[model samples]
Target: MLFQIEDIITKMQDDKTGGVPIRTVKSFLSKIPSVVTGTDIVQWLMKNLSIEDPVEAIHLGSLIAAQGYIFPISDHVLTMKDDGTFYRFQAPYFWPSNCWEPENTDYAIYLCKRTMQNKARLELADYEAENLARLQRAFARKWEFIFMQAEAQVKIDRKKDKTERKILDSQERAFWDVHRPVPGCVNTTEMDIRKCRRLKNPQRVKKSVYGVTEESQSQSPVHIPSQPIRKTTKEDIRKQITFLNAQIDRHCLKMSKVAESLIAYTEQYVEYDPLITPAEPSNPWISDDVTLWDTEMSKEPSQQRVKRWGFSFDEVLKDQVGRDQFLRFLESEFSSENLRFWLAVQDLKKQPLQDVAKRVEEIWQEFLAPGAPSAINLDSHSYEITSQNVKDGGRYTFEDAQEHIYKLMKSDSYARFLRSNAYQDLLLAKKKRGPHAYTHTSCLRACVKKAQSQVNQQDDKCLELHLRKGDQGEYQPCVCLGIQGWSKSSKGKSLAGKRLTGLMQSS
Candidate 1:
């Protein structure tokens, strides 16, 4: 698409009347040469491309400018404006059609040359200056060589005519503008990964569409094959058969191992599986009762819930109570930094984009840097990768380090935690109240029925004895007296009922 658009732009440049009017513009002190107004470019695009909307034409012009076909003469930003903004055609040599893959060395030399020039127009932008500093540190070993090359280029550039130098400098800047564009500008030079792979390993094209032989097309001398093709022998066939047999055996062994792992996992968790074993307090989905969920969320978890933590390290970390217990265990062993670093990395992934860099730096300083307050042990490879990634301060800067710490905790600390007395005691501790324990509403209903049975039998002693345990406060005195109302005379019963009602309301 870019190449085709560049062809159209070339035609537009060549046309005299229906094309962009190119001319030199005299500024306050100097002449801006071979530049066209952005308005002229937009008008030409709308006329030739049959585009009705001026905005569309301007957008097309911007796309062409972004691809380095044209650029603003005075700005690092490669964009087209539908006003009097001056844009100059980029040199054909620097066009993306040439597959210009500029390297860091070339970029460094260009930046260095800009620094040598005392012209105000050649001053680097803030981002460019920062990039130059970083490149210098990266290529410190070859700094002398790079400096010499930049000095040589600057000397040659000075020899050119002033107008010619201005054109050349702007063209070179535009090339970099397309490659390492301004921070927000789109980098048009970035190729698709699929296209890059195709370029690496291109498929052969058939020369003749009609399937004609190459020898018939042009009478050339026939050449012998580079290497002699040999027929397959019995030994080769037998070797292939043996290789196939070995592959089958290996596949079978892998299948057996997978089956064994699945069986072991199923056995370990079968008791906790709601489908295999009925839920202790009934599954909420199957029954309307939410006793199972309530039990799981309780401050003092049930034995079954605690037992699930022992099934895997992930399970232990997943449960709040279990994770707190594990953290305590880690603190006792003075290795809580591993879990802390792991959790910090997890949290870093969820941070807002604006806060990600700050949080990344905090995590690195707290757990990964040299002499860090709570440094966790990391292998040399992970440490090196993390150290390099910390410079960017991205969200995933600690991915490798986090993975290493997680594995360390799972293999060492998690196993030890499960075996620790703290965890074992929790798993063995009997729950004071089970899910089916009597609630206050249920107890109240049972007491009411017992009192009614005693009242019908006219056994006041039995009713009082059952309702109140005298000073022990087994039941409320109001409830005990409330039942006496049913056994007394009509007047006594009315007085008793009023008294009980008052007591009940106050209580």
Candidate 2:
């Protein structure tokens, strides 16, 4: 039996192409003056659409009412009521206070009108935002299902690659083969539609019409039948994989387009409103406070500070340490006199081989994790240890700085080398100009004491050589006698220097 109107289970409203694309009611409201009362909006919907159905009008009105006209989406117009529950608008600019005004609850209903146009325009905008979001969601779900199907197919392909172990596998295959003619009605229909490529075969595109051909003129118009597009095949899978590899081409294109469109919208919109500046927001529709800033300054390694005082909804990372970390790490790098030098110098590598921090991280995970390689056999890996490598000098990535750290912490010779990179600059300055370069008598003694011990353990005469290269840059080498060398060499330096000599001669 053919279906009639009474027999129809799904109407256009209920057809669920995901959801109906209703533009944000708030925007439409904004275009008009004010329509706080339900009746006014309901009337507008009726006059606007020539909608005959009372229920449909009521539904559309409810959509507007729910939005409460503050946000760009939904009924952002705040429908203030004395007693009402608070809920967030699915879009921007809406606050619960709009609907639930703090002191104004005496009236059963009150509509706020910043301006008459603000009310109408907001309703229309809300309508547009809602509809576009719904359209995007419907499309997004389609993409998601496609992705899931692709993932499942990959898993199936992986299973097919494994060898069958049982002796009766052929018998099992025969049984599966006999039943494999079917994939249920829905899946079979999908499978058929997929096989039909309008591009490859002309029959697939046969008189593309929304419904049955107009030639078959009849009383009722059939709803459009959309044939599903076919997915890529095994050959196409290779191309898809290649496409996935070029992520910048696919993902970035959409993102780049969106960014360009947004910029164009801003640039064009600025002429309409001169307040628009690259520095600050000019659009009344958009909020400047939409984005938050990290105002909290927590830690100061410069001074001792404690943990966990300030991560809040309005702002997070408040402690001095948190704010200072980025600055201090950038400023006070010990390796180079200035941090900008490393930043200003360009390296052609995607991530340079010479970037000690990155290389060390790779070497740490790749080479050292398996246990420090026997020094004799370590050269087989592709990561070459080149002399060009520079000290990372970045404190932020200290934990991630793989081998540079491992060599510092591990090898006896390297411990001295690690301890030594600091001293050679001062010492080099010293031998060239006699000894006035010393700034800290106390800290220098402690450093030299540590270096002396590390050098003494190994016998290459450990002559306190300056600058040997490896995972890190050539260190400013200085000697120490620790459980290996002497502590006094750095502290009581020259007993009395030429400054004292001059004083003695004067006396």
Candidate 3:
């Protein structure tokens, strides 16, 4: 559609009759060159396309302008209006039909060149200024190169005639307007969602009986007669039926295996799932408590949490306590280099682009170099790949080696770590604490009693309160006399009872 409209626009730019009047429009202080009025464009569209409605012609003109065949002289918006607003035809080289997909570097250079120019007409817009700043940060390492190219282009542009320069600048701006339209404007260069999906996962092309592709067949100059369709025979039908039965059987077997795997995984992790199995100390979000989070952050791991480490190597590494235990186990086995190498590779991925080369070299020297102090084993294929990658000095220089070591540790070292005494000791310690040892009520009671003892040591006459189990299995307040004699007045007893109740509730 864009190509078809551009062709019509090309004909409309002709100097002969039927073309829109192209002239210089003199404003207050400046002359706009090679421009046509929006009214003239709409009238030409209505006359040449034989459209009876003026509204339809204006609509068509707006579509053409949005596609960047032409643009208004003084607006960032690319829309046609039925008025005397001046518009210019974009240069043929800048037309969307040319398939110009400018990269960020090109845009950055153009914006940089605009900054160097002193003319107000070439000044960057607010959004363009923001884009330039972002591009500078993104391409920081090569910004010097981009600036040099922009300078060279600016020098060349300076030698062009004043009128030609104005036209060229407007054309370039319109080209970018189509590619990176204003925030509210429709971006004409954006592909349809369906087209993007088709590009990502295209269907296989059909091939002819001669093994030529359908596209090639259509483009071929030689004429070929179509072959008659062959009739299906009973033997072919039987073969197809047998093949389909086999496929069904295989599919059923695959589904059954998948179902079993899912069931096993659920059973293994059911205890760890807070929703299915109630969390110890209650869920924080539901109960308005942070006990569960506090327990996880503590140095000691719970028995259930430690047990989850056996489920997967990733599970073990994800838990800080479990990871520390595994590291100790590896150190005892003198194979800690594998874990260290894997950690270094992970960190390398996060390094900035300018620092990647330095980090990559350091990682290679420490992990993969021959006779290195803490070298780990790697297969010949991975070692060779790592060697080549190290020469390139990229962030993933040891990706293959890291992956190999990870699988080795997960299959061998991780299994042994689960059975090691260090991990079993942690699980046993947590198990001995049991569910009753650290109940919330017991901890609160202990804190209240400790406060009571501190007060008694300071003032021996201070009242004390004790919490006792009630009939409903909840804590009830009970007054305990201090070292002083009890008051005999009814008012004194009532005040003491109220104080006891307050202490119990606060605890």
After the best TM-score superposition of candidate 3, give how far the Cα of residue 25 lies from its true spot, in angstroms: 24
Residue-level lDDT for 70 in candidate 3: 85
The TM-score, computed over Cα atoms with residue i paired to residue i, of candidate 2 is: 0.18
lDDT of 1 by residue, 82-130 (tens): 9999989988877776655555677788898898888899999999988
Q: Which candidate tops TM-score?
A: 3
Runs in model 2 lying further than 4 Å from the true structure: 1-38, 43-305, 308-507
- Tally clashing residue pairs in candidate 3: 0
The TM-scores, one per candidate, come to 0.41, 0.18, 0.44
lDDT of 3: 0.74
Q: Tens-digit lDDT track for model 2 on 417-471?
A: 2234332343343343221112234444665555544432434333442111212
In order of listing, the candidates' clash counts read 0, 65, 0
Expressed as tens digits, the lDDT of each residue in 431-465 for candidate 3 is: 65444223366566784565455431334466554
Clashing pairs in 1: none
Better of 1 and 2 by TM-score: 1
